[model samples]
Target: MPAVTVEDLTVLPRLARPGLGDQPRPVWQVTNAPSGYEGEGFPVRRAFAGIDLSHLDPFIMMDQMGEVNYAPGEPKGTPWHPHRGFETVTYIIDGTFDHQDSHGGGGTITNGDTQWMTAGAGILHIEAPPEWLVQKGGLFHGIQLWVNLPRDAKLEAPRYQDLRSGTVALATTYDAGALVRVIAGSVDGHQGPGSTHTPMALVHATVEPGARLELPWEVEYNALGYVLNGSGTVGADDRPVRTGQATLFGPGDYLTYAADPVQDGRAVTLDVIIVGGRPIREPIAWAGPFVMNTKDEVLTAYEDYQRGRFGHIPV
Candidate 1:
């Protein structure tokens, strides 16, 4: 991965269409899925990494954790690790995700659960399947997105927001063709539970065939739409997209998306995530696991971790 700085993508351009009121927000660009690689123990397809994009401001990286069926004892998850200057947002769709962090934060998330952790100053954590799930062998799938923190507040006290399944804000369309779960920010007046340092919206949308959703978004925020399952179209332009794809949109206060239900009365379900946030637009000095504003700060962070400055994980 190459080192990406604010200079590299500050001027992100968008493809314009007839209008936001009628046209599907123009699909500026479609992402190319990179091959899957096992990180330490977790099998993942890195959807996007800040280091690979022209604009990686509020977000640094996103991973689609294994959606594969794991036989008993087949899944090896990430062990204890340290982080600083960023937040990790994990959403579980199937099976269970168990985690233990040095901060004494321990929990298990099942279907529809989301855990948001801000490793401000620093923290040590482990993420793996629950022992029972690992033994039983079943479906394991989830998403983990790295949300970046502003430089000035990089060293603030760490915090965690654990939202159990069905606890996060949710909205269903009038036609019942679409369902949206809010992880952060608001949708159709429904608000999420996570307290964020930046102004943003992270939502998971599932749309049945022929169903539609229009989100009132701010034109100033950088917006991204990622397809998780099935096929769907976005904006007034009706730009189509399939699974394993993401679309970056230009300035628009509203975004519309729908699934193309074309089967024999069986709705072709479309699952996608839409996220928008104000870009920090500052220099990014990124090192493995640690993201700071400068190289000197990154080096200092490594030194602090080596010296046990962030505190210790209970054995």
Candidate 2:
């Protein structure tokens, strides 16, 4: 939960209040994420399960990895794998992860760091806990989001971006009751450090008890909100939402979130991640690790990967 913090939020820039005639987004749907095990048995909540792909457009899926505290020798990670035709954005909130890819992109990202990998064309990669972390375990919590590239850019080139926590743009609500970390795209006039191939915005916000956060949003992008901790209400209509829940917002010029005045002992504030992107609207043929515009293209990716065209594991 400690991605980034500031003791004096009042010192940060404040987001402008919604102007007259600005339409507040209405709640379209609220879904409870189903928990399941992922890569080497780590727990995860599938954030986009049961949602239509049309609503998620340029974004494919998201996973909220463990808020679990692992004892020594209990932590686990993914095995080497290949991906094609998309990008993976992994943001670490409370732990460390090591990433290595065949394209020579590798790094260690700790709390509040991000690894953005574009598997444009195709690539082989692996993510795991550092050896030291595996021997002396600790808290691990993070998010992995899949962003789809346009059909034309899907095979351009592979690339990577390591965005440190310090680089994220920070802003607060007008009353300083919430802290907003802009990880990608622009929020109002505040821009995050992430360089995206698609038009999108990603934000992590912590709202104080009883505070309301109203954010202006892009009219062309579809908006979604996922709660990571505490209870809150989404939209101006106040539909109740809580941990492990995802909300889809309807058309509007702005979005609203309000934290309840009372929270359980374990949570002091409501933490949520909001994301939006312009719809690609192209046919998607997604198989294990490949997302393409057509089934034939996905088959080609499989064949290319099998032929070792995605590259080999580093010696």
Candidate 3:
């Protein structure tokens, strides 16, 4: 397994880079972003939101919002917006967010809760800190990932899976130093409750210092790890990753992550999310909130929103 050191948190021992048939091990691909800002009205890094839909198939965009310690009166959030032809998965780590859509769906996703919305046909929604949170002001950290829909399911219908914190599936590693919350996929034999438009796994893992976690994944799926907190090494290339960085893994049957051992009394843990899915070979035409297969379809989505087809939130 690849390893990371506790001192400087750099990659330590890297195991053999294996071939596909060599019992499946993840090869470190690329490390990008010292981290930057993108549309959360806060600091965030754009994960898979790119033009190459075929490459990051079944997944479109991922935004990691603040693990920010917001000062007492300065919280930011987005207003009502329209989306079509895809799904948006929102995972909250800390703080509160009240979500509402025109389809008569609205709920709150507090810490560890998930809101998986399939904007199959089209829908308008609002996501912002709740009245209580906005009034009191505190830390707010979360992510919203866009999962692409195939051409057939593009306009099926809009749906929402507002999962509570306790209801989400949890799995423990054999040694018990780690806990994984399966949001949309299986991890360590436990499966998430969220449904999917694509075959994928979205898991948030927290591993204690000195623990080496090896996760098995389908060989045909594409996977990557995002370091949300602390530091660790990822994959057989044993790429060292600190907070706010994302590492894409090459083909492998299992991915390895190791948190640095404790130097002083305090130990460095690893908090990250692993996303993997079977590639959906399809064309993509995306414009802001609307993701479709053609430019004309994109235009139609905009026109529909402009024409008030997507319902509105009551004032």
Candidate 4:
């Protein structure tokens, strides 16, 4: 686990979306203003595609979205949808979402709130627009991440944790002018909220221009960085990376980053969800929004949702 310089890092090609029926469009590499949700009014833009990291080992996908304004009294999000075999984390950076699920979980995720939902066996849920955000006409932005459950926990009982911003801890490494907020794991001797059933670590980071930060890597896991704003170079081997992109690191024990000194007025801020576990290496039978090891399991999940197996959640 020797430390490598940034110069040796290789830049991998960005992943593209798979073909859809008849025709399909190319996928984007960086986070952009999301188009309105398909059929629904919420905005959604994918941050990663084709499943990064180990298959159902640690994390599966990441989607970042924003809504600056919504029509008055208009619905703002996806209708009830089903999910199984994974955990969903919705972190609200701004605005609010009135969320409800079939398992008797319902609440509003306000600014700086986090909703961790484990759709272990099965769950149908919907996230709707909050009246305040719709009325005030302000900016709303956040991210949704999907973490895969371990094989043993795939069929476990579902649960939810609504965490306030004050409950999470933040640590700033002054040397690099970097702020690391612990959302799921330990960072700089500080721990985050909500215990994860699987071994996972997530941190939201911000770096000032010309600053350099070093991240210690863990063995037995894959690591990647998602740039949210500004631009910089990230990698153990001095690879040149920029904002609106994800840098997948190769096998290494540590990573180093340096903000572009030339961009003196600009800074780089990003969320790094470092996740990995013993790789499942099993077949991935994914359709629509559900991912399972076998196609039969996926079909069963859809059937269960349609049959009202996931009954209405109480407010």
Candidate 5:
């Protein structure tokens, strides 16, 4: 839960209150994420499950990796995999992960750090816990989001961005009741460090009990809010949402979410990840690991990958 925090939120730049002309985004739907295993059998919550692809345009899917405290020798991670036609954003909230790809893009990211990998054209990559972490397991929690690239940029060269926690932009509610960490894109003039082929914004916010967070958003981008922990109400109408839930919003100029006045001891505040992106609105042909614009393109990706066109895993 300690993705990033400020001892005194009041010291941070405050978000501007919604203007008179600002329109609040309406909550279109709320659905609970179903729990499952991923990678080498680590627990995960499929945050985008049951959500419509149209609403998630410009974005593919999201996985909430364990908020679990693993015992020694219980840690796990994903095996090598291939991806194309999109970007993978892995944000570590409370643990460490090692990332390496065949394209010479790799690093170790820990609490509050982010690894933005653009799998343009194609690439092979792997993610795993550090050896020490695997030996002496500790708390691990994070999010991995798949962002779709525009059709024109789908075959461009691959790129990677190692965005450190200190590089993230931070802000607070006007009343200093909530903390907002901008990981990518801009929020109320606070901009994140991660760059993307898509126009988007990614934010992690922690709202104190009874606190309300109102954020100005891009009118052109669609919006979604996923609760990482605790309970809250989304939208102006106060639609209830809780941990492991995702909220979809209709077109609007701003977004609103309020944490309940009471919370359990385990989670003293409500933690949420908010993301928005301009729609690509292109056809998507997805297979096990490849995401492409057509079935033929997907098949070609598989063929190219098998033929070692994506490059070899580092020795």
Candidate 6:
């Protein structure tokens, strides 16, 4: 396969929508609001809502939330909830999240930690503030991604992987002043931690101003780059993107990204969530927090939750 370059990536401009004026107070409060994205009781807010990147595929939704001030001793966290027919990947950049599920799975995810939860069949889980985090007010940040499961794997057993920073592989492109942290899949010949059930790639990249980097296309999957901080340009041919937005690329095997030397003079951190899989173009019967192939399946999940079939706490 040919290596993709910065020039091959297309940039799709993201239309700016009216944002809540004056950055929401206590960012966490706004995100954790009862009626926000995800659903009620998912305490850690400050999430940037994202849509399905590809037309139909293994991935469904992605949310990046962070750069928020967290007060010490605050009882802020996600309550119990159930998920089916999908997986949840949580990457923590700041603070800590204590995760527990009914499958007898539990762990504390700190900065530079990754929690990959495969909610096959069914699972009930809760992420809450650790005692230490609650007492020590500081900055808390992270990203939560939702990946759809293939039909055959939908009813498989649930699994979880906790990866520390050192385990994940990193590929650096010095010429382009860019470095990519591979969370899954191969990047620049480097493989990442956390085994993926499906063929998918998730990378976190940082590019210095005026630098350029190219990504090869061997895996046919939908790709997108989300700007976390600073501004830059991405795309190929007629496509180009600006900062503070996500640029969805077109069909191709490779794509390139370049930072504007004049505007992005310094290094800019970009959180790129690249996901693609053989499209599962199946009907989606989603209800509040449960997503299944049919409405009956959704109902079954809820019924199980009510019956405490998933259990009250981690098994």
Model 3: per-residue Cα lDDT over 3-122, one tens digit each: 111332222222223345755455545555445764457677775433345656788878888777777667777878899999999988888878888988989887888888999889
Residue 188 displacement (Å), model 4? 4.7
- How do the predictions measure up, each by TM-score? 0.87, 0.99, 0.87, 0.79, 0.98, 0.78
lDDT of 5 at 216: 91
Top candidate by TM-score: 2
The residue pairs that clash in candidate 2, if any, are: none
lDDT (Cα, tens digit) per residue for candidate 5, span 115-192: 998899999999999999999999999999999888899998999899999999999999999999999999878989
Expressed as tens digits, the lDDT of each residue in 133-182 for candidate 2 is 99999999999999999999899789988899999999999999999999
Number of clashing pairs, model 6? 12
lDDT of 4 by residue, 1-315 (tens): 000112211231111222232121112222333233642756665665544445335667777665344455553677788788888998876677788877777898776678999988888888877766566565566778888776677777889988777777665544535555567765435667967886666666655577665654444555656665566766534556654466555554545565665552333243343443345555666677677778898899788877877676555
Per-residue CA lDDT of model 1 for 28-47, tens digit only, reads 77785564755556667677
lDDT score at residue 199, model 2, on the 0-100 scale: 90
- Give one digit per residue, the lDDT tens place, for model 6 in 69-173: 766654367778888888899887767788888877899887777899998888888887687777887766667777787678888888998888777776656
Q: What does candidate 6 score in Cα RMSD to the true structure?
A: 10.3
Whole-model lDDT values for every prediction: 0.75, 0.94, 0.75, 0.62, 0.92, 0.62
**Model 5 ranges off by over 4 Å:** none
Show the colliding residue pairs in model 1. 23-236, 23-237, 24-235, 24-236, 24-237, 25-235, 25-236
- Each prediction's total of clashing residue pairs, residues at least 3 apart in sequence or on different chains, is 7, 0, 0, 7, 0, 12
Best by lDDT: 2
Error of 6 at 90 (Å): 0.5
Off by over 4 Å in 3: 1-22, 34-40, 49-52, 263-268
Q: TM-score of model 4 relative to the true fold?
A: 0.79
RMSD of each: 8.6, 0.8, 6.1, 10.5, 0.9, 10.3
Deviation in Å, model 4, residue 204 alpha carbon: 0.5
Model 3 worst lDDT window (10 residues): 1-10
Full-model lDDT, candidate 2: 0.94
